[model samples]
Target: MDLDLAAVRAFVAVADDRYFGDAAAGLGISQQAVSKRVAKLEADLGTALLRRTPNGAEPTEDGASFLVQARALIALADQAVDLVRSRHRALRVGVLGTRIASAETVRAFHETVPDVGVEMLRSEGLADALTALARGTIDAFFGRALGDLGGIEARPVYLEPVHVLVGRGHPFAALDGVPIADLAGRSLWVPGAVRPETEWADFYRVLAAEFGVRVDTTGPNFGVDDLVERTAASPELITGVGEKIRVPWHRGVVQIPVVEPSPCYPWSLLWHPRNRHPVLPELVAFTREGFRPYRPGRDWIPEPDRPAFTA
Candidate 1:
């Protein structure tokens, strides 16, 4: 008997939710439509899948067992379609402001895979980058997981710990790594909470709570120039970075580690679920492999006896 995959997906949803109304809502269809589809599935399977109750429906033993197969089939089918679609000629990738800071990653991508059409879309805000990924404007971007990014997929490429960016004259600049408790009333140049998306807006909130750091709100833009300028100009202000910013000429500025901070940049290579470019997998695999257990914050020192990140 020929059975439609749509009917199967609907049936799985019904089984999971245990209510026809919820299944219909999830599928964006009418309740009657859902019942009809499920009924048709039951007819094909030749069994009574659901036993109706006053509160909600419960799947029979057969229905529950069949749900496993149905959900698996739907998921595998979707993945197969996605894999097949990824075989396209050009790979569209979105570069967040932070990844662009690296410069080498961008240049390497082009040099590494010249055939795939590379389009560089600049995003100042993480929310903006994630939005583009969901909206299908761009394939993937470098971002940290925040809020509820439903359709987008994220694969962590590398991690950079939070560091203290201070000016040369600052007292803390001379220290090995400033303790987390020391930042209680310290003026920090922090990324603002009201971001492009409401979901990721709470990341900083959680960070502040965990680190016990009080931050004064700053700009939404992630401009390298702005960061460099802020770190240089503001003696009292410290901008966070994963690694030490050792600018030899900057006599007035310093980038020190924050002893240990919970807020870290897990540089993830994110992409849309539908993007089917072959280069994407290669790029993602390469970066994930290259940066696995990659810690940029841990700097190596020349002296055998001394540890790294000490003045």
Candidate 2:
């Protein structure tokens, strides 16, 4: 039978308080209203649930049996409500990969706001992450914002310095920092950048076109470990990695800073304008407050990303 939850709630309150007046006080309703609700519930169930005594009311034998089920029903209803409202769900955040600089930033943000629940979703790249954000599959995303974002809101969050990775035998491996100009005509192999429309591929394309550096996209793209192993064995071939990316260690490989107007990867936090996750604002505020502004002359940012980072 379809039960009126309000009436069931009123009955539970009266059974617990043993007095309609006390139950009304707890429920912030009048005693007469509580009695009317309980009376209606009794008529619906075709059984008297409460009996008024000299001191107070007590549940009948049938009421005692139904009380347990009534409480369970209320609990299930409340859980369903909370689930739909997203009150108990963890905040879902999309990132390109767990080893990159953005992942480190997410880790730090989580530590700062330890009370807030956060779930990190590993996406392929910015394009994939933005699609997830638009579809409401993810609450927020961390990546370089490029081109038209449609209705999504984006904020420049961090500028991670770029580093050149070279085998120990390479000449630049011994240097403290390699000037950006020195990279001209040098082959920089990036295996996974073969994907055409991805964010990092576009970034590298722009960088290569502007800087005259040759970006080699040759491979059967394995993973980072394979990249690191290949880089350690090849002295002539080099690669670029973000300073904060946690690459697997190779004793023969050395990471040298890229200087003389260092090229920095611009990271931005992206979310739908309509997103109302409780942790979104906190994360945005934390990003704004903690951001280290870009140095115009000392840092080189791509043209499309400049507006967000420079401003």
Candidate 3:
């Protein structure tokens, strides 16, 4: 309905006092505002909420029914606050990956408080996080560095520069940073390589198109095991993944930095509009502070950290 809290509160006061001037005095507002609100509320609901009689004012049957709802709304609002105060010890959270964040600090904070319960979950990637976010299964997620996140209604927490992953014995593997051209003629193991171009895929193609680089991409993009196998077999093959994926086996695989005008992927903390948890507001603020980027903050990251992308 078009009814507002102000109007509802005014209506309640008027119902209790039964006198416009007295109700106005109790609410600390002018009687005209009270009258106008009543009229607007009635117009919005298409039913008169109050009737003028010789004895001040009285609520009609419809008004009485609405009064019940209004009072219930107010009571529930009060009850919601009470619930927060009483039951905040249990908070369920989803983390994109166990390795994706400064989870230790987050856990420590929750532990210190003793009044909050923090739970975490793992996700496949950004898409997984978004799916969980849409379903209300998880409260937050972190993902790889590409995409414009501005319009997604999320607040970013941290970002690290993108890195290239290649097997250790590969010729270019030992390099501190490889030129974008270094990847030009390589048999690239790219994710979503075999799939038709998506708008999101187009974003990844910017480098290939702009640098006149040709890549041989074929296979599922999500498998790290496959990338490792391809790298072990082909010196020309390489795949890109998030910076957070630490190279576990130094003997076979290594992550070399991308030095020539590289891009950074940001991991974000996103919450739903309806996710109004008791400890969430505090947790989000702390997480933002904890994961805050370096000196330049958002601007410090390498080229084309354009924004977090969503499809």
Q: What is each predicted model's overall lDDT from 0 to 1?
A: 0.65, 0.87, 0.63
What are the runs in model 2 whose C-alpha is more than 4 Å off?
Answer: 1-84
What are the per-residue Cα lDDT tens digits for candidate 2 across 42-67?
99999999999997999999999999
- lDDT of model 2 at position 286: 78
**Model 3 TM:** 0.55
Candidate 1 yields a Cα-based lDDT of 0.65
Ranking by lDDT: 2, 1, 3
Please provide, for model 1 over 14-103, each residue's C-alpha lDDT reduced to its tens digit, 9 standing for 90 to 100: 888989999999999999999998898899999988889987888899988988888889989987886676566456666554343333
Q: Give me the displacement of residue 244 in model 1, in angstroms.
A: 8.0
Off by over 4 Å in 3: 1-90, 101-115, 124-135, 144-152, 192-203, 210-217, 290-311
- Give each model's clash number: 5, 0, 10
Question: What would you estimate as the lDDT of candidate 3?
Answer: 0.63
Q: Best to worst by TM-score, what's the order?
A: 2, 1, 3
**Where does candidate 3 have its weakest 10-residue lDDT segment?**
294-303
- Best model per TM-score: 2
| TM-score against native, each model | 0.56, 0.73, 0.55
Give a tens-digit lDDT track for model 3, residues 129-190: 66676565666544433454333346666655556777666777768887766666654455
